[model samples]
Target: LTVGPPPTPIPNPQVVATDFLEVNREELQRWVRGEPGAFDWSPFIQHVCKIEGRGEPWQEKERRLRGRLRRILPIDVHCADPLGAPLRPPADALLSTFCLEAVSPDRAAFGRALLNVGSMLRPGGHALLLGALGESFYLAGAARLPVVPLDEDDVRGALSDAGFTIRDFRSYAMPPALRTAVDDVQGVFFVHAQKPLEG
Candidate 1:
Protein backbone atom coordinates (compact mmCIF):
# COMPACT_ATOMS: atom_id res chain seq x y z
CA LEU A 1 0.00 0.00 0.00
CA THR A 2 2.91 2.31 0.67
CA VAL A 3 4.61 3.49 -2.54
CA GLY A 4 8.30 3.88 -1.90
CA PRO A 5 11.40 3.65 -4.04
CA PRO A 6 11.54 0.35 -5.92
CA PRO A 7 13.44 -2.33 -4.03
CA THR A 8 16.66 -3.92 -5.25
CA PRO A 9 16.33 -7.08 -7.32
CA ILE A 10 12.87 -5.62 -7.97
CA PRO A 11 11.54 -7.65 -5.00
CA ASN A 12 10.67 -10.58 -7.26
CA PRO A 13 7.34 -10.83 -9.10
CA GLN A 14 5.19 -11.46 -6.04
CA VAL A 15 6.21 -8.54 -3.80
CA VAL A 16 5.99 -6.04 -6.63
CA ALA A 17 3.24 -7.59 -8.73
CA THR A 18 0.85 -4.92 -7.54
CA ASP A 19 3.13 -2.46 -9.28
CA PHE A 20 1.63 -3.76 -12.52
CA LEU A 21 -1.45 -1.62 -12.05
CA GLU A 22 0.69 1.46 -11.75
CA VAL A 23 2.14 0.54 -15.12
CA ASN A 24 -1.16 1.71 -16.63
CA ARG A 25 0.09 5.28 -16.40
CA GLU A 26 3.11 4.44 -18.50
CA GLU A 27 0.99 2.54 -21.00
CA LEU A 28 -1.32 5.49 -21.41
CA GLN A 29 1.63 7.75 -21.90
CA ARG A 30 3.00 5.42 -24.54
CA TRP A 31 -0.31 5.27 -26.34
CA VAL A 32 -0.33 9.04 -26.48
CA ARG A 33 3.18 9.14 -27.81
CA GLY A 34 2.33 6.77 -30.63
CA GLU A 35 -1.09 8.13 -31.44
CA PRO A 36 -1.91 11.33 -29.61
CA GLY A 37 -4.93 11.65 -31.79
CA ALA A 38 -6.30 8.47 -30.24
CA PHE A 39 -5.22 9.28 -26.72
CA ASP A 40 -7.90 9.80 -24.07
CA TRP A 41 -6.80 9.98 -20.47
CA SER A 42 -9.89 11.54 -18.92
CA PRO A 43 -10.77 8.49 -16.86
CA PHE A 44 -7.40 8.19 -15.16
CA ILE A 45 -6.93 11.93 -14.90
CA GLN A 46 -10.25 12.17 -13.10
CA HIS A 47 -9.16 9.44 -10.72
CA VAL A 48 -6.02 11.41 -9.94
CA CYS A 49 -8.08 14.50 -9.12
CA LYS A 50 -10.22 12.48 -6.76
CA ILE A 51 -7.05 11.33 -5.04
CA GLU A 52 -5.90 14.96 -4.65
CA GLY A 53 -9.44 16.07 -3.61
CA ARG A 54 -9.60 18.51 -6.49
CA GLY A 55 -12.85 18.32 -8.46
CA GLU A 56 -13.05 21.19 -10.93
CA PRO A 57 -9.63 20.78 -12.49
CA TRP A 58 -10.22 17.04 -12.67
CA GLN A 59 -13.43 17.51 -14.61
CA GLU A 60 -11.92 19.91 -17.11
CA LYS A 61 -8.88 17.76 -17.70
CA GLU A 62 -10.96 14.62 -17.98
CA ARG A 63 -13.17 16.16 -20.63
CA ARG A 64 -10.23 17.36 -22.70
CA LEU A 65 -8.38 14.05 -22.57
CA ARG A 66 -11.46 12.06 -23.48
CA GLY A 67 -11.94 14.24 -26.50
CA ARG A 68 -8.35 13.82 -27.57
CA LEU A 69 -8.25 10.04 -27.24
CA ARG A 70 -11.58 9.56 -28.97
CA ARG A 71 -10.32 11.63 -31.88
CA ILE A 72 -7.18 9.58 -32.40
CA LEU A 73 -7.98 6.00 -31.48
CA PRO A 74 -11.23 4.31 -32.34
CA ILE A 75 -11.42 2.85 -28.88
CA ASP A 76 -13.95 2.83 -26.08
CA VAL A 77 -12.50 3.26 -22.62
CA HIS A 78 -14.77 2.40 -19.77
CA CYS A 79 -14.88 1.46 -16.11
CA ALA A 80 -16.67 -1.83 -16.24
CA ASP A 81 -17.67 -4.50 -13.75
CA PRO A 82 -16.63 -7.70 -15.44
CA LEU A 83 -17.98 -10.02 -12.75
CA GLY A 84 -21.20 -8.20 -12.00
CA ALA A 85 -22.11 -8.24 -15.67
CA PRO A 86 -20.65 -9.47 -18.90
CA LEU A 87 -18.83 -7.04 -21.16
CA ARG A 88 -17.38 -7.40 -24.62
CA PRO A 89 -14.20 -5.97 -26.10
CA PRO A 90 -14.19 -3.75 -29.13
CA ALA A 91 -13.95 -5.60 -32.41
CA ASP A 92 -11.75 -2.98 -33.95
CA ALA A 93 -9.60 -2.27 -30.91
CA LEU A 94 -5.97 -2.92 -31.67
CA LEU A 95 -4.98 -3.13 -28.02
CA SER A 96 -6.97 -4.15 -24.95
CA THR A 97 -5.89 -4.68 -21.38
CA PHE A 98 -7.43 -5.83 -18.12
CA CYS A 99 -6.46 -5.96 -14.44
CA LEU A 100 -8.51 -8.02 -12.06
CA GLU A 101 -7.89 -7.97 -8.33
CA ALA A 102 -10.88 -9.97 -7.05
CA VAL A 103 -11.99 -12.76 -9.29
CA SER A 104 -13.41 -16.15 -8.53
CA PRO A 105 -11.17 -19.02 -9.52
CA ASP A 106 -14.18 -20.68 -11.09
CA ARG A 107 -13.14 -22.16 -14.41
CA ALA A 108 -16.40 -21.22 -16.13
CA ALA A 109 -16.21 -17.57 -15.16
CA PHE A 110 -12.54 -17.38 -15.99
CA GLY A 111 -13.16 -18.94 -19.36
CA ARG A 112 -15.94 -16.48 -20.10
CA ALA A 113 -13.78 -13.52 -19.18
CA LEU A 114 -10.93 -14.73 -21.32
CA LEU A 115 -13.26 -15.37 -24.22
CA ASN A 116 -14.65 -11.90 -23.82
CA VAL A 117 -11.18 -10.45 -24.00
CA GLY A 118 -10.50 -12.29 -27.25
CA SER A 119 -13.87 -11.44 -28.73
CA MET A 120 -13.49 -7.72 -28.18
CA LEU A 121 -9.92 -7.03 -29.12
CA ARG A 122 -8.93 -6.99 -32.77
CA PRO A 123 -5.99 -8.93 -34.03
CA GLY A 124 -2.68 -7.91 -32.44
CA GLY A 125 -3.80 -6.42 -29.10
CA HIS A 126 -2.24 -7.28 -25.79
CA ALA A 127 -3.83 -8.60 -22.60
CA LEU A 128 -1.86 -8.22 -19.40
CA LEU A 129 -3.11 -10.05 -16.32
CA LEU A 130 -2.11 -10.05 -12.64
CA GLY A 131 -3.65 -12.43 -10.19
CA ALA A 132 -3.00 -13.26 -6.57
CA LEU A 133 -0.09 -15.72 -6.55
CA GLY A 134 -0.76 -19.12 -4.99
CA GLU A 135 -3.48 -19.57 -2.47
CA SER A 136 -3.01 -16.66 -0.08
CA PHE A 137 -5.11 -14.67 2.33
CA TYR A 138 -5.61 -10.91 2.13
CA LEU A 139 -7.93 -8.39 3.74
CA ALA A 140 -10.13 -6.26 1.56
CA GLY A 141 -11.34 -3.50 3.87
CA ALA A 142 -12.10 -5.94 6.69
CA ALA A 143 -13.09 -9.08 4.84
CA ARG A 144 -10.48 -11.62 3.86
CA LEU A 145 -10.24 -13.02 0.36
CA PRO A 146 -8.43 -16.28 -0.27
CA VAL A 147 -6.51 -16.43 -3.50
CA VAL A 148 -6.67 -19.66 -5.49
CA PRO A 149 -3.30 -20.45 -6.96
CA LEU A 150 -3.22 -20.79 -10.75
CA ASP A 151 -0.70 -22.75 -12.77
CA GLU A 152 0.67 -21.93 -16.21
CA ASP A 153 -1.38 -24.59 -18.01
CA ASP A 154 -4.61 -23.23 -16.56
CA VAL A 155 -3.64 -19.77 -17.75
CA ARG A 156 -2.58 -21.00 -21.17
CA GLY A 157 -5.89 -22.73 -21.79
CA ALA A 158 -7.83 -19.55 -21.08
CA LEU A 159 -5.65 -17.55 -23.42
CA SER A 160 -6.06 -20.15 -26.13
CA ASP A 161 -9.82 -19.91 -25.94
CA ALA A 162 -9.52 -16.16 -26.41
CA GLY A 163 -7.56 -16.81 -29.58
CA PHE A 164 -4.40 -15.37 -28.14
CA THR A 165 -0.87 -16.64 -28.17
CA ILE A 166 0.91 -16.43 -24.85
CA ARG A 167 3.96 -14.29 -25.30
CA ASP A 168 4.94 -14.51 -21.64
CA PHE A 169 3.58 -16.13 -18.52
CA ARG A 170 5.19 -16.56 -15.13
CA SER A 171 4.49 -17.15 -11.44
CA TYR A 172 5.72 -14.74 -8.78
CA ALA A 173 6.33 -15.10 -5.06
CA MET A 174 5.37 -12.48 -2.50
CA PRO A 175 7.48 -11.24 0.42
CA PRO A 176 8.37 -13.74 3.12
CA ALA A 177 5.97 -12.14 5.55
CA LEU A 178 3.15 -13.02 3.18
CA ARG A 179 4.39 -16.47 2.35
CA THR A 180 3.24 -19.69 3.93
CA ALA A 181 4.68 -23.17 3.69
CA VAL A 182 1.46 -24.83 2.60
CA ASP A 183 -1.56 -22.84 1.37
CA ASP A 184 -0.06 -19.38 1.53
CA VAL A 185 2.37 -19.84 -1.30
CA GLN A 186 1.73 -16.16 -2.15
CA GLY A 187 2.01 -16.55 -5.86
CA VAL A 188 0.32 -14.77 -8.79
CA PHE A 189 0.14 -15.14 -12.55
CA PHE A 190 1.39 -12.55 -15.00
CA VAL A 191 0.55 -13.28 -18.60
CA HIS A 192 1.04 -11.19 -21.70
CA ALA A 193 -0.74 -12.32 -24.85
CA GLN A 194 -1.42 -11.08 -28.34
CA LYS A 195 -4.02 -12.00 -30.90
CA PRO A 196 -2.83 -13.05 -34.30
CA LEU A 197 -2.50 -10.06 -36.61
CA GLU A 198 -3.90 -11.48 -39.76
CA GLY A 199 -2.54 -9.93 -42.93
Candidate 2:
Protein backbone atom coordinates (compact mmCIF):
# COMPACT_ATOMS: atom_id res chain seq x y z
CA LEU A 1 0.00 0.00 0.00
CA THR A 2 1.03 3.65 -0.52
CA VAL A 3 0.36 7.14 0.85
CA GLY A 4 0.10 10.21 -1.33
CA PRO A 5 3.03 12.62 -1.47
CA PRO A 6 2.80 16.17 -0.16
CA PRO A 7 4.51 19.53 0.36
CA THR A 8 6.70 18.06 3.05
CA PRO A 9 5.96 17.45 6.71
CA ILE A 10 2.68 15.99 5.56
CA PRO A 11 1.28 14.89 8.89
CA ASN A 12 -1.96 13.71 7.34
CA PRO A 13 -3.35 12.94 3.90
CA GLN A 14 -6.21 10.94 2.51
CA VAL A 15 -5.19 7.33 3.09
CA VAL A 16 -5.61 5.10 0.04
CA ALA A 17 -4.29 1.57 -0.26
CA THR A 18 -2.82 -0.40 -3.18
CA ASP A 19 -1.30 -3.86 -3.36
CA PHE A 20 0.17 -6.06 -6.12
CA LEU A 21 -1.64 -9.24 -6.97
CA GLU A 22 -4.40 -10.26 -9.35
CA VAL A 23 -5.54 -13.34 -7.44
CA ASN A 24 -4.83 -11.91 -4.02
CA ARG A 25 -6.39 -8.65 -5.10
CA GLU A 26 -9.57 -10.43 -6.07
CA GLU A 27 -9.53 -12.28 -2.76
CA LEU A 28 -9.13 -8.98 -0.91
CA GLN A 29 -12.06 -7.59 -2.87
CA ARG A 30 -14.21 -10.51 -1.90
CA TRP A 31 -13.41 -9.89 1.74
CA VAL A 32 -14.21 -6.19 1.39
CA ARG A 33 -17.56 -7.12 -0.17
CA GLY A 34 -18.23 -9.43 2.78
CA GLU A 35 -18.33 -12.43 0.50
CA PRO A 36 -18.35 -15.86 2.09
CA GLY A 37 -15.15 -18.00 1.73
CA ALA A 38 -13.04 -14.87 1.36
CA PHE A 39 -9.74 -15.04 3.20
CA ASP A 40 -10.05 -13.44 6.62
CA TRP A 41 -7.47 -10.96 7.90
CA SER A 42 -8.61 -11.16 11.50
CA PRO A 43 -5.39 -12.68 12.77
CA PHE A 44 -3.24 -10.06 11.11
CA ILE A 45 -5.45 -7.26 12.40
CA GLN A 46 -5.32 -8.60 15.94
CA HIS A 47 -1.52 -8.89 15.80
CA VAL A 48 -1.17 -5.37 14.48
CA CYS A 49 -3.38 -3.93 17.23
CA LYS A 50 -1.38 -5.81 19.84
CA ILE A 51 1.85 -4.45 18.45
CA GLU A 52 0.41 -0.90 18.21
CA GLY A 53 -0.32 -1.00 21.96
CA ARG A 54 -3.19 1.42 21.45
CA GLY A 55 -5.75 -1.10 22.74
CA GLU A 56 -7.83 -0.36 19.68
CA PRO A 57 -10.32 -3.06 18.82
CA TRP A 58 -9.22 -5.27 15.94
CA GLN A 59 -12.62 -4.96 14.27
CA GLU A 60 -12.33 -1.20 14.25
CA LYS A 61 -8.89 -1.40 12.77
CA GLU A 62 -10.05 -3.90 10.18
CA ARG A 63 -12.96 -1.74 9.20
CA ARG A 64 -10.74 1.32 9.00
CA LEU A 65 -8.19 -0.48 6.80
CA ARG A 66 -10.77 -2.06 4.55
CA GLY A 67 -12.48 1.25 4.06
CA ARG A 68 -9.23 2.98 3.10
CA LEU A 69 -8.25 0.40 0.51
CA ARG A 70 -9.87 1.25 -2.79
CA ARG A 71 -7.37 0.15 -5.39
CA ILE A 72 -5.02 -2.72 -6.01
CA LEU A 73 -2.43 -2.77 -8.81
CA PRO A 74 0.09 -5.26 -10.08
CA ILE A 75 3.74 -4.31 -9.70
CA ASP A 76 6.61 -4.92 -12.08
CA VAL A 77 9.68 -3.72 -10.24
CA HIS A 78 11.78 -4.01 -13.40
CA CYS A 79 9.50 -1.67 -15.29
CA ALA A 80 10.62 1.90 -15.63
CA ASP A 81 7.27 2.69 -14.07
CA PRO A 82 6.22 -0.02 -11.66
CA LEU A 83 2.54 0.73 -11.93
CA GLY A 84 2.62 1.46 -15.70
CA ALA A 85 1.41 5.01 -15.14
CA PRO A 86 3.65 7.14 -12.97
CA LEU A 87 1.75 8.21 -9.88
CA ARG A 88 1.58 11.98 -9.95
CA PRO A 89 3.20 13.68 -6.97
CA PRO A 90 4.50 10.17 -6.25
CA ALA A 91 4.01 8.30 -3.00
CA ASP A 92 5.28 9.39 0.39
CA ALA A 93 6.32 5.89 1.39
CA LEU A 94 6.79 2.43 -0.08
CA LEU A 95 6.98 -0.90 1.69
CA SER A 96 8.79 -3.80 0.04
CA THR A 97 9.31 -7.26 1.47
CA PHE A 98 11.51 -10.05 0.12
CA CYS A 99 11.15 -8.57 -3.32
CA LEU A 100 14.52 -7.17 -4.31
CA GLU A 101 16.57 -10.30 -3.81
CA ALA A 102 13.99 -12.50 -5.42
CA VAL A 103 13.99 -10.53 -8.64
CA SER A 104 17.69 -9.72 -8.76
CA PRO A 105 20.28 -12.04 -10.20
CA ASP A 106 23.18 -10.32 -8.43
CA ARG A 107 24.10 -7.36 -6.26
CA ALA A 108 24.39 -4.98 -9.24
CA ALA A 109 20.95 -5.98 -10.46
CA PHE A 110 19.68 -5.62 -6.94
CA GLY A 111 20.94 -2.04 -6.80
CA ARG A 112 19.33 -1.19 -10.11
CA ALA A 113 16.07 -2.78 -9.00
CA LEU A 114 16.11 -0.75 -5.80
CA LEU A 115 16.69 2.43 -7.78
CA ASN A 116 13.72 1.58 -9.95
CA VAL A 117 11.43 0.90 -6.99
CA GLY A 118 12.66 4.00 -5.16
CA SER A 119 11.56 6.07 -8.11
CA MET A 120 8.01 5.84 -6.76
CA LEU A 121 8.83 7.28 -3.36
CA ARG A 122 9.06 11.04 -3.14
CA PRO A 123 12.00 12.84 -1.69
CA GLY A 124 12.15 12.75 2.13
CA GLY A 125 9.88 9.72 2.11
CA HIS A 126 10.98 6.45 3.63
CA ALA A 127 11.13 2.95 2.15
CA LEU A 128 10.83 -0.02 4.43
CA LEU A 129 12.70 -2.99 2.93
CA LEU A 130 12.73 -6.52 4.19
CA GLY A 131 14.67 -9.36 2.55
CA ALA A 132 16.70 -12.46 3.13
CA LEU A 133 20.41 -12.14 3.84
CA GLY A 134 22.83 -14.29 1.84
CA GLU A 135 20.14 -16.41 0.33
CA SER A 136 21.05 -17.76 -3.11
CA PHE A 137 18.03 -19.88 -3.86
CA TYR A 138 14.69 -21.03 -2.54
CA LEU A 139 12.03 -23.59 -3.36
CA ALA A 140 8.70 -22.80 -4.98
CA GLY A 141 7.06 -26.18 -4.74
CA ALA A 142 9.25 -28.43 -6.92
CA ALA A 143 10.89 -25.51 -8.65
CA ARG A 144 14.13 -24.17 -7.18
CA LEU A 145 14.08 -20.45 -7.73
CA PRO A 146 17.38 -18.64 -7.88
CA VAL A 147 18.01 -15.31 -6.15
CA VAL A 148 20.82 -12.95 -5.38
CA PRO A 149 22.82 -13.61 -2.25
CA LEU A 150 22.91 -10.35 -0.31
CA ASP A 151 24.75 -9.31 2.80
CA GLU A 152 24.48 -6.32 5.15
CA ASP A 153 27.16 -4.31 3.36
CA ASP A 154 25.47 -4.87 0.01
CA VAL A 155 22.15 -3.51 1.20
CA ARG A 156 23.77 -0.60 3.05
CA GLY A 157 25.85 0.44 0.06
CA ALA A 158 22.94 0.07 -2.34
CA LEU A 159 20.78 2.33 -0.20
CA SER A 160 23.53 4.92 0.02
CA ASP A 161 24.29 4.82 -3.69
CA ALA A 162 20.59 5.09 -4.44
CA GLY A 163 20.58 8.41 -2.50
CA PHE A 164 18.77 7.05 0.51
CA THR A 165 19.82 7.92 4.05
CA ILE A 166 19.73 4.98 6.36
CA ARG A 167 17.54 5.66 9.36
CA ASP A 168 17.65 2.12 10.72
CA PHE A 169 19.19 -1.20 9.70
CA ARG A 170 18.63 -4.42 11.53
CA SER A 171 19.37 -8.07 10.74
CA TYR A 172 18.22 -11.29 12.30
CA ALA A 173 20.44 -14.34 12.04
CA MET A 174 18.90 -17.59 10.99
CA PRO A 175 18.78 -20.20 13.71
CA PRO A 176 20.49 -23.51 13.05
CA ALA A 177 17.45 -25.46 14.16
CA LEU A 178 15.34 -23.77 11.51
CA ARG A 179 17.97 -23.93 8.77
CA THR A 180 16.99 -26.33 6.00
CA ALA A 181 18.79 -27.57 2.93
CA VAL A 182 16.20 -26.12 0.60
CA ASP A 183 17.69 -22.64 1.02
CA ASP A 184 20.95 -21.20 2.24
CA VAL A 185 19.53 -18.08 3.83
CA GLN A 186 21.86 -17.05 6.65
CA GLY A 187 19.54 -14.42 8.06
CA VAL A 188 17.22 -11.58 7.19
CA PHE A 189 17.47 -7.79 7.18
CA PHE A 190 15.15 -4.86 7.59
CA VAL A 191 15.96 -1.29 6.61
CA HIS A 192 14.18 2.00 7.03
CA ALA A 193 15.77 4.45 4.64
CA GLN A 194 14.73 7.91 3.51
CA LYS A 195 15.31 9.82 0.30
CA PRO A 196 17.02 13.16 0.59
CA LEU A 197 14.75 16.18 0.53
CA GLU A 198 15.02 18.20 -2.64
CA GLY A 199 17.16 21.32 -2.44
Best by lDDT: 2
lDDT of 1 by residue, 26-124 (tens): 555555465555556567777888888855687675544434552122111221332223323333323322233235446555665566545545576
TM-score of each prediction: 0.47, 0.86
Clashing pairs in 1: 37-72, 38-72, 38-73, 39-69, 40-69, 89-120, 133-187, 133-188, 134-187
In the order shown, the candidates' Cα RMSDs to the true structure are: 13.9, 4.3
The per-model lDDT (C-alpha) reads 0.52, 0.84
lDDT of the structure predicted as candidate 1? 0.52
Q: Candidate 1: which stretches are off by over 4 Å?
A: 1-101, 177-185
lDDT tens per residue, model 2, 1-199:
3355654555434343445568876887898887899998899989999999999999998887777666666777777787787877788888888888998888998998888888888888889999999899999789999999998999999998899999889999999999998889999999999998999
